[model samples]
Target: MTATATEASPTDSYHGFLESLEEADEYAAIDTALGLIDAGVPAERVLLDLIAPAQVEVGERWARNEWSVAQEHAATHISERVVAAVAARAVPRPTRGRVVVACMDGEWHALPPRLVAEVLRLRGWQVTFLGASVPAAHLVSYLHRHDAHAVALACALPMRLPHAHRMIEACRRSDVPVVVGGRGFGHDGRWAHRLGVAWAPDAPAAADLVADERALRRVRPAELSQLADDEYASLAKRRGELIDGALADLRARAPGVREYTTAQLDSTVSDLGHIVDFLAAAVYVDDGSLFIDFVRWLIGILASRGVPASAVGLTLGYYVDELRDFPRAARFLGEASASAAAGTGPRAG
Candidate 1:
């Protein structure tokens, strides 16, 4: 029995799986779906029908900010449980194959690749999930040690694509297939073909392609680096638009300063302070002089009259403390700032 072989008594249906998301009973939905898979549902149906719909709900909820991280985590945990439960019951075929799944180094989103592994496992393939942010060297060493038949890489951030590309090349010398998937693929489906390797639009699509034996064996010629000039341009343009819109909104709200009230200003100041801290940590200073000026302006605004520098510094300290847990240089400054903000009110400059 090959990995791609069809089931004897397929249990789950497409419509039935779609309905489960509407039900929103995470555990029950996943558990029931796994029950069907355990009873011999087709691997394709399990992915396209059951898992995909549920994930769409999760993604939509996340986009609207309607769900907490804990809520999202709960859904994902349930889904993982379902996948593992079903996989446990899968009878491995005579020639069970192997796949390596990993997030590119510096990328933290793990659900995509983890789900992909579960899908492949259902098809009777073995999987090695390296989880998130694994360094390039470690991944290459693991590939050599495991001699995986295929590598599945996921990246949620476009900035990590270069690292992903590097990892793809690492697997090339071994003749192992690479499947790149996730939010980072961007607007161009052509980027997939251009990668000079197979790319799945999502987990289900990738599994379907791999399940087809003919598609698995063919290797296309390597085109120029997938990290092209235009791809970076697209990402940069989008990022700039977001920043511009945010700054414009801030300017619009600036005139109604009194409307902020005490609580509202507190909230606004708190959020802006955190954002500045986050940007400072994540963005590269060498990117350009504009970004450097922008950061400076941001700090100045938060510290300007009608806003308290202590509160700003204190909030910044909170974020810094998160990254550096012990012996923080900012602790004393943060304490002083908090004391000043409380004594004079956050409205004082």
Candidate 2:
């Protein structure tokens, strides 16, 4: 049996960490984080240098449009689970105070808030994580019930901003300091200032803002608006590059792998490729027609290959891999054409 390839150190760990993440080796990243902890890396260091970097890559893959919603979701869940596990065993410090972490209404992505909870929990703060999409009323009621020193809100899409603003106001009226993070928050940081809340770009930064009264006092929501916009644009651009590079890189890396590897690789690649497509649609669909027509053509060909209709859903699951073999995909279209001689599934109309 072949020995598994291994990276030399944690500094070099991120590249392989990203590959393992790409390959969807969830536990591998977890185990690496644990190893870093065991190696006497501080919990904050583990989070800031190791786990945070990993999450950044995962987020970038999503932003670059390299991963589909499902791929991004899977990676997010894995990273969260891994971080939670590591955090569970984390050495706790004295309580800074209790804080509630939640996703604002209409905001389904929770990884940002979860990360904030973990970061604070590790810092010895009493953290209550309410997960994603909590209703505005419930969040406000919970804040009243717990009287938390602070509340942190996460929203990934700009569409969620209106809901986030409502939640922020609800918390503020109750005299609770609200901290808003995630992609959408930065888009309108100035608006957050008007609401009298704090805005953080990511969890680690949130931790600082939450624990230091002076730091929290120093934060101006108006200043935050530009910060959020800057952070959002930066993350969006970086994520796009990472994903674009990853799609090209992973596709180029696939044919050399084994069949079992190929199947999995193909699936992941397709998912990432689809993610890119989805983001492109999200970002630019209003501007002009995109690749829906091309995708329809490809989907029709794959449908004819004895690859079941249900498997078509898996196409989005493996977007990067599918795009890698444009020639092969075309050849398969020819095979699919010949195979059309035999009755199969529905063809593209």
Candidate 3:
């Protein structure tokens, strides 16, 4: 039976919506959203308050190990459907200039930006949502062809900030103003400032920023003078070699790894690469806290999966030793390693 929103409180509706996602019931989730709309709830509210928070919870559940990756994907897909249902029920005619929304290169999380796109549409802007992992050149070409008034770029992971910087510059070169948001920019958008791009905390802010041409284009000059040292560049070039060395070090230190399954080995390699990528981003932005925060996040993630925090500490130690010649990279690693050892790493936002 289809659920109705006859007397459902906002809290009840949100919980039920999450329940539907947990069950992978697309119809039920859509019904919950539509029901809210029928109950005089604004479609935009349903999109932001209802669908958006539910997706965030879905990610938290996966992070906590309470939900598997497959479960998270299913929940995200259902949320996408709910967003579509709400949009379909209340399609607004675009009354403003065209806005292009896209994910940075290598950023695969499209749902957050999709919410921004729908909200922009609700507010009467012509929004073009280019989904996940859009390459820089292709995006620039699209912007040139469309004559967009502004572009909103998203980066979900801090490790992708280097690529995000490149893409932001690419858009600016074409004379299209850029506004970026997401956890990648730091919860407070500090990293966005480092990259020298305008930022919005969420969809509504993005909409407001997009509508104002001056604010969107009033970004400060990028503070990447630290890149002059060539540390970030050298670290990126040695990515594969670093991962290999870390793996060899891990195998020697942890004999249990020698008997691990293929999946376990693959995950280890990915983690090592993540450490290097995130370190390079920190070096690029000249921030040690970025790497420290990532270490905290990595510790929690690995802890939830039964890996010890000491494993991360070991890896950081290895990187510090190997990159000792690169002053910036070495300092960042040393600081993070100390934090990880002292259990003082700041929580990821």
Candidate 4:
């Protein structure tokens, strides 16, 4: 009476796989993926369909406050184990050139790029997956030492786009063509376009892009002339000062924050820094929507944790007044504040 992989819908397999992730049952998750492969499901499908979507849901669950950080970490660990297990079962010989895949500097979510690495391996490319948060200098040195045909980079957070750009430029300097992906580049990779690098929406596209040498190297010029304004640099230089000022403003405006526990205080500081970083990234790309979208997302994340949206509004107001001299940054802050007040910001998934 048991359903076979073919008999079971992809939806059923995904739900069962997600359940394994939820329970942190590494064995069950591995068995589920391996079972799909044994039942003639392509290994690529098992990776992109079963594992990829499940990992995304894990992130969404954490965002919605249904899962704690510990739970999410546990689930992610199990997923990584599952990926390793699946990869071990199907060792494909490389038939194509070497492609190096890595997370951008400061980008800690290695799983996404790992999946991409596995896919490239399956597609016959010898892929070296340099896991999370690789520094630019080290990555450049590695590329120089090894004969890398191309490099694929990942960034999961939009706030890291500026850093991602620097990393991409470093790879370019080493004469390695770069293909960038992940949510950090925006869902459609608009931010990657702004950085003037090649972009892929997912693993399959990346695999294809890396195979075509000419296409992989064909990148438009980076549209960062706005950096001439010096606002992003100025804001970045004052990041520490801005965070300290925001914390002081918060304590004065909301006395309850003054009594927060050490952990809460640490989280508050991180959030304050994220706001400034996202704002700076927006200015770097000259895109107001980047900052606006982050504001909406931050409001939702805070709300799920029982924090009020008005608190964010208050902080935005403070930033707007503080940065009035920086026309571009101040204008972006005003747009975010207005979006938050009008409740027009999209709901965070």
lDDT of 4 at 305: 89
Global lDDT of each candidate? 0.56, 0.60, 0.90, 0.90
lDDT of 4 by residue, 291-347 (tens): 999999988888888988888888899899899999889999999999778655345
Which scores greater on lDDT, model 3 or model 4?
Answer: 4
lDDT of 3 by residue, 106-211 (tens): 9999999999999999999998999999999999999889989889999999999999999999999999899999999999999999999999999999988988
Which segments of candidate 3 are over 4 A away from where they belong? 1-9, 343-348
Evaluate model 1: give its TM-score.
0.56
Total residue pair clashes for candidate 1? 0
Question: lDDT by residue for model 2 over 1-349, one digit each (tens)?
Answer: 1223232235656676667677788888788777766665656666666666777777656644567668877777777777777786785875678989998786677766777788888877888999988999999888888868888888765435445666777887888877777755434354355445677776777888898766665554432233332422333344456456665554455443234466666765564455444333222212111233333434444454434333333333343343343332323333333333342433221
Instruction: Estimate, for each residue in 1-349, the C-alpha lDDT of model 1 and write its tens digit.
Output: 5332344322334345434544445566666676666555655566556675676677556544566557767676666666665556554662567788888888887766877877777667777788998898888888788867778888765445455667778777667777788765443434345456677887767777666646855658655542243433333334444344443455454565446678766666545543433232222111222222233333444444345444444444443444242222233334334444443322110
* Candidate 4: worst-modelled 10 consecutive residues by lDDT: 1-10
lDDT of 1 at 111: 67
Off by over 4 Å in 4: 1-9, 343-349
Query: Model 1, residue 38: what's the lDDT?
Result: 58
Q: Which candidate, 1 or 4, would have the higher TM-score against the true structure?
A: 4
Point out where model 1 deviates above 4 Å: 1-27, 38-40, 202-205, 208-349
Error of 1 at 209 (Å): 4.5
